[model samples]
Target: MVGIWGFIPHHRVLEEDTILQQQQEFEHSIHKSGSESDVVESIDENTEKNDKEILISKRISSDNEKEHENENNLEVEIQDFDVDYDYVPYKFGEKTYKIREIRDEANRPWWKVFDEFEYRNTKSEAKSYKWYKWFPEGTSSAEKKLLVKLDIFLAFYSFVGYWVKYVDSANLNNAYVSGMKENLGMKGNDLINTQTVFTVGQIVFEIPWIFLLPRIPITYGLTIAELFWAAFTIGTYRVKTVSALQAIRFFVGASEAAYFPCIHFLLGSWYLPHEVGRRGALFYIGQFLGVLTSGLLQSATFKNLSGNGGLEGWRWMFIVDGGISFGVALLAFICIPGTPAKCYSLFLTDDEIRLARRRMKKNGTDVNQSTKALFDLPTWKKAFSTWHVYFLGFINILGFNSNNTSSGSFVLWLKSLKKYDTVMINNLSTVPPALGILYVLIICVGADITRKRFLFVSLSFLLNFIGNTILAVWDVSYGAKWFAFCFGYWSWSQSSVFNPLISDFFRKDTDVRAVAWMAIYIIGLQSSAWIGRLIWPTTASPRFHVGFSTCAAFSIGFAVFIGIAYFFYKNDERRESLENGIYLYNSETGDIPQFVLDHPEFVEKNRYD
Candidate 1:
């Protein structure tokens, strides 16, 4: 039912008859006015010259007249507005952002940030390129200020939320290595089993929540999820047995499940194409930062507070981490703008809200506020039947496995060497993630600036292949082992690219987006859960030949997936360039389109070709 991949559907397409009819009517009007001297450019030449900026309906109603009077007067201004491209109207959706005026913003600097931002997955382009690779580009002064506000308000909060999440999630491994294993008398595969239990809880809730996100205000859901995760995380501080640990982790995992798809759906709903990739990387960086923070906190807790609090240092890690989540939950409740259309963040005036929605609309993603749901069974059918869901979902399965979910292996490997103390081990585990942050900063921004997503995506996969290839040949030198672990983190940077890429592919519809992300987790997480328990059992230690080989093969699979995906991406791009203007994907059809309705004289089925 979807249009050709990468084909945006909003651009104007005028058939010759339609053009001739309009031209003839214009000529008659001119004759009646007796202005026979007026110059008339050929419609074909005019259309061909402004083809990229395909004309759109400019009809304005009474209510919108004041708002659009200036917008309608806009002309081609290449420096600020850049090149015009085809626009496709989003056919279905929920949520619309509103804006009241912010008179003070006329003078605000583009680089400075004030207080708030929230929303996700929509595309925004950066027409201007900056020499500085670390920063995002803005097409004009207004957009520059807007990007700054969004970075601070919506994007920053989402980043921190995911960052804090990793703190709680990554702790199980950190806790075990420090002292939990010996203290609790843990047995075989217990480490993997506890994680599996958490994964099980996550998969259990991920489905229903996909339906639930559409029905609920975003902040309300995220606040509850944060609180639930916090409470369960704190509960972990008191657990005494392995069974108790497993039980608490399941609740923690279930509550935490809401964050991923909901945040991503919002992300797609709000951002422009040029902006999402780096912002996604920022959201991802917060995660590694959290992991780094947790390891650092674990090291500090073990050394400074191990015996002072009458609780094990490992236990204290849970309590402090949980306390942080409580603070984040409060922030979410108070400030996280759910969607640009429904946002009421204390930081933004009504003006900024309208601005956010406008950005979305310009990018062809503005949707009517009542269009999606957790159980839109028809939309789900449309979503599942699309080629994107399966292709990207399979790639994510490889990514989920290759992403340093297999990370603590380095920690265990360091442990097996008995070369470092517990504190050093925690510290060492952070190095790869630290390096990962730098990798994403460089690679993602470069990809965003160059607008070559598949190019960088392919490069990351190549790095993943190289890293795992070295590790799989386990009979290597110590230097090789060290290099393999560090190199994998670079590939880990690919997760950021994957996030925006999926958002771009599924950006057209909320219902479809929710279903797509859900399917990915349902498949990806299951693969991760069983794969970790099987190939990466705790018994394998630093020399997990099976684990390394499995990871190596998955990296190769990820590379191959992107190669095939890029072809579709380009093919779709080619389709969008056609003058007939491809049909906006009719999701209701629920299969590869039975026909290309826009092509003249090339009808399908009983129609003449």
Candidate 2:
């Protein structure tokens, strides 16, 4: 019992200020050692020459220079147990101390080189202590195995969900011309409005749900949302009026609002930075898989299910899709992890949880405190202060344009062409979107390995812009139009970077992190939904050239905007690192990486800072 209750000596909850002060002193020391630190900035002759300094805090110290630098280094080596002598506390509690690193001329603290456990112990200890040893809850072997399985499962589930959403949206177009008009008496843009309404639903509830998701069981909220969409999806089959269809679609949209944000939060909870992108791509794969599945399924069943048991093929599509959603939702509830502490049920051990906490803490995101309040002020200020949020919004509009004009309506456009048989059209349709999934994986993996994302995202948007341009100007070959369709799928690849970027923007503020993420989704999602309607009107059916052109322009415009924002934002990551007191070293150059995720203590620090 003593082992369970008292595992270690009194532990200090390392607050953000302590972290920030340590980082500041570290940076100051780096600045002071002009020559020694210069070694860190050494040129890599093989790589292209760019003036970007990746990290402000991390630097390479040559082994030869180590002895001399170590001697000359004015910073004291604060032992893990020596913080009481080095730092003066601003506040005092039995389990806490407002600690500061001893500063020198360069403001480098003696504690910079200390390991996190040592650093933490030097400053404060918990109110109680235990002489007994306590074994962690899970074994090392179990933790490793659990993480791999969870990673794969998360990737697969997310991918499937994305596929379902996109495939379902696209199928509406296929149904519209496959006798949906005659069966339902639907006319004009009412078809477009359904898609528009869905986007609005996504926009309206995304932020609130994201804010609320982490507070409760994630599986519970996600399952409820899925159920709503599933019910609406089935309800769509019964709609005989625009009002009826609109109402059902609106509810469906609301149901889906939580899916993206919720999944993102889920992914973040389980994976580290390098792991997030590829895992995210798994979700995008769902879009690709959904597209493939829809085409194949539609080709096989459209004719047979056309009049099966008093339901048209189109009606069957909704019923089947909705049913699948409901089933998947049920499965997800049983599988998804609620939080890191409890993930041991998924086979993780107590040590892995400790390591996970330490890893995230070292990565600069503190998950120790209540995540509910992370979005309060400093985080929102960080989120809203930058142009990245607005750029993300515009990019979302670009994504909406691509999804609406090409993805949602591609089948109808092909039907209007009268160029190929159902199988041929279905097969041809798969190419463009399949390329999109490919591009998303390639870009995400590249970003993960290289530790650079914004540049690749910009380049992808440019490629999409070029693809849309060809579709807009050249109409002679069906091949050129086909190329445009493929390019449109890549548009969502740009969306992949947005979430990761949001993670960076608020890496310091835990209180408002969830809400900040929700704000990001709301702005990008809602604005773009309306934009999709404005660009692709119902009247422009058969050929959505104008809409495609508008999409191209937004895609290009957003790319350009992101580029400019990148320039202006110009790697304040070191500043944030110092402000947060964590080192996320760039693996390639051995410098601190330019991107930072929020620490969990941003809210509490804000009031005092």
Query: Which predicted model would earn the best lDDT?
Result: 1
Instruction: Please provide, for model 1 over 365-444, each residue's C-alpha lDDT reduced to its tens digit, 9 standing for 90 to 100.
Output: 53334343336566778788868878878888887787544547888888899779999998888887787788777677
For each candidate in turn, give its C-alpha RMSD to the true structure in angstroms: 15.7, 16.7
Best candidate (score: TM-score): 1
Give one digit per residue, the lDDT tens place, for model 2 in 494-556. 566657666655554444556667765676667667677777777787566777678678777
| Shift in Å, residue 276, candidate 1 | 1.4
lDDT of 1: 0.67
Model 1 TM-score, 2 decimals: 0.75
